[model samples]
Target: MESKTGTTRRDLLRAAGLGLTFPLLSACGGLAGGGNSSKNQAKSALKIGFVSPRTGAAAGFGEPDAYVLDLAKKSLTSLTVNGTEYAVQILDRDSQSNPQRSAQVANDLINSDQVDLMLTTSTPETVNPVSDACEAAGVPCVSTVVPWEAWYFGRGAKPDQKDAYKFTYHFCFGVDQFHNMYTHEWPQVPTNKKVGVMWPNDSDGNAIRAALGPLLKQSGYTIVDPGAYTDGTNDFSAQIAKFKAEDCQIFNAFPIPPDFATFWRQAAQQGYVPKIAQIAKTGLFPSQVEALGDIGIGIAGGAYWTPTFPYKSSLTGVDSKALGDGYQATGKQWNQQLGPSLALFDVAAAVLKAAGNPKDKLGVANAMKTLSVDTPIGKLEWGKGPNANVVATPILGGQWIKSTDPKYKVDFVLVENSSDPNVPVAAKLQEYKP
Candidate 1:
């Protein structure tokens, strides 16, 4: 590691960061480091294991990964710890958006590759299993994108569990963020306050349904929940018919990319379009909107990252605009995953340096338990978050619309930011006309 650069390229000599992997070592490796043995491992190149969904349904979140990894490769070529410099290698893997694969890759990184630290992200499917693998293996891990509640409780961790998941920490929005962003963003359009929610049977769906549904009800809106549907179900006729029959004027959902697309297209075909189709988990990217052709124009969703955010990546010292511009240079529209995905390594680099020795797993985990690094998304600190092992990052409300800009076919305009007013609003809300 070099003080000037701070990190180096992690190789695939074995396998992945997510457009979300947000690093590794094993049981007999850095976990019990000290004296000459510790020094020996510290002198070796620091290996980081990154996991994400690059080839599956959640691929939208992985779109900016290559660009982010490229920047990390250039900026992370060297790392400095306790005045000692060591080479860095980042090994990234693809979850295929499957939780089982996520666990397998994480185990491979920890037990096989002997990664020093671990970072994974995107959704619970990718984040939870990878985090769980690290937790069981005693490897320090960090992640983002999924709601904090989903990552925490969904992992069978209780609020009073006392020091739950010491090896794994998380940073992302929670139910309260949805209560704020949705309550503030939805009222922009005149409605009867009737919301149709389609929560799935997965981790994200279960968490949202348990917390967010009640909040919307307390806010004086009538929630019509169609119960939990299994993921990858191509038919949503029953759910659509219920919404249409109830005359629900607003809609909400937390589903994977393909599931949402299938349900949404089915809803439209069945004549069940809502005025404010506030969505989560999906519809946060430009290509997602482009997939629906014109139907995606006014559909609303939450943004975990965007170019308008007035922040910068700590590793490359590139702000939101610079990051966005760099991706646009690649001829791809900017994505919300760009900031957080890159931020994962930003925190990883900081954690490695703060660990005093890159090879010490306990030191790395302890550092992750407290280290707060300024990232492209915002300030991500562990203890400062909602729980000891969680950082409640900001989530803003936005909508997809036609883009006059030559580079993009559709533009994601920020319409509400009450969750974090520091994030400036770009445009007013537009009602989705069926």
Candidate 2:
């Protein structure tokens, strides 16, 4: 729950219920009574609010956030707009990995702190709610980490719709990108094409079930879905039995971290190991896999970002390896969320600077629509994507390998890069030997 500003989001919640809501209201209320001069002087610095799930079930996404935020603040401390030097103030808030809390903090950022721009990350749990708040409040927002379809259609935007939400823009891979990765990697493992799926009755799971399921089925694969289970479910014995009975040798799931850990352990104990456990959502981070011990080896997952990616940060010009090295140097583990998290700031800086007026929310949001900038995850082109406000990043396919390498406990090696060939393949896809 720690933040780069020396204060945690939990501290704000404790000091004032719902993240300084009452106090912020009172303070802003008093500010409204001030003369025009005082109000104008308040615009001396540009305020940006960054929200993420720093705690709860998805806390791993925020482990290196504090460090990244500190780096962002140092590099983007000041910028000139219209010949005026403006100091930048970034207020970080924790979503607690809950949708309600995500919206509440975003509201406070837009209305209370008067942030000109908003940035949110992690998953649908945090991104959807924060995007809702920003879109409703007419604040320019940029988000990453979540799938594009989950963030777009999960919020009720229909397929092929352009500019469905004008104020909010998202940059990440969608189900199509995942489909490409899965189809490319699954064949290498040599399965019976009967894939077992765990589709929870949630945004990410549902979206994958509806979209990815059909894609696989169209490609002549038999899908064995055990109905939709809820997140945080403890027992997966029934689901394992169904997959075992069907003799399904390939498994895939887009679930939260803890649920995957629980189900995988149960599946192993039940002797229902699949040839390729092409899991998503979870298994992107090292700690999640390390928790599974030897069972974690050869577990295939989609890679959104990796240290070996051939890209550099637009803000700092630090390449993928350098960024990962700097993070590992902090005595912390390397994660896939690092590149996209930093890309959020890179896009923020470009959007605000291109706006010509940093204080004008509408101007900045408009600039983001046509903006294309080179990020750590490669070039994010808003105009070239399926949606006007959505820029699809590459979704590489990789597997977690249990290694004796001194640097990593479980190393993720790239296997497929159909979306972006610039990302090199580090290893060939291997069958799970469980």
Predicted model with the maximum TM-score:
2
Instruction: State TM-scores per candidate.
Output: 0.90, 0.91
Q: What is the lDDT of residue 316 in candidate 2?
A: 78
Number of backbone-clashing residue pairs for each candidate, in the order shown:
29, 0
Model 2 gets an lDDT of 0.88
Q: Candidate 2, residues 292-353: lDDT per residue as tens digits?
A: 99999999988888888889888878888988889989987788888999999899889888
Q: Write the per-residue lDDT of candidate 1 for residues 1-434, one digit (tens) a residue.
A: 32223332353222134431122232223234434565676567888999999988999889989999999989998887777778899999999999999999999999999898888989999999999999999999988889989899999988677468878988889999889999899889899999998899988899988888888899999999888999989999999999999999999989888988898888888888799988888898888889988788899989888888898988889999999989999988888899999999999999988888778888888888779898999888777777788888889999888999976789988999987788889988888974
Per-residue lDDT, model 2, residue 284, is 86
Cα lDDT over the full model 1:
0.86
lDDT, model 1, position 282 = 85
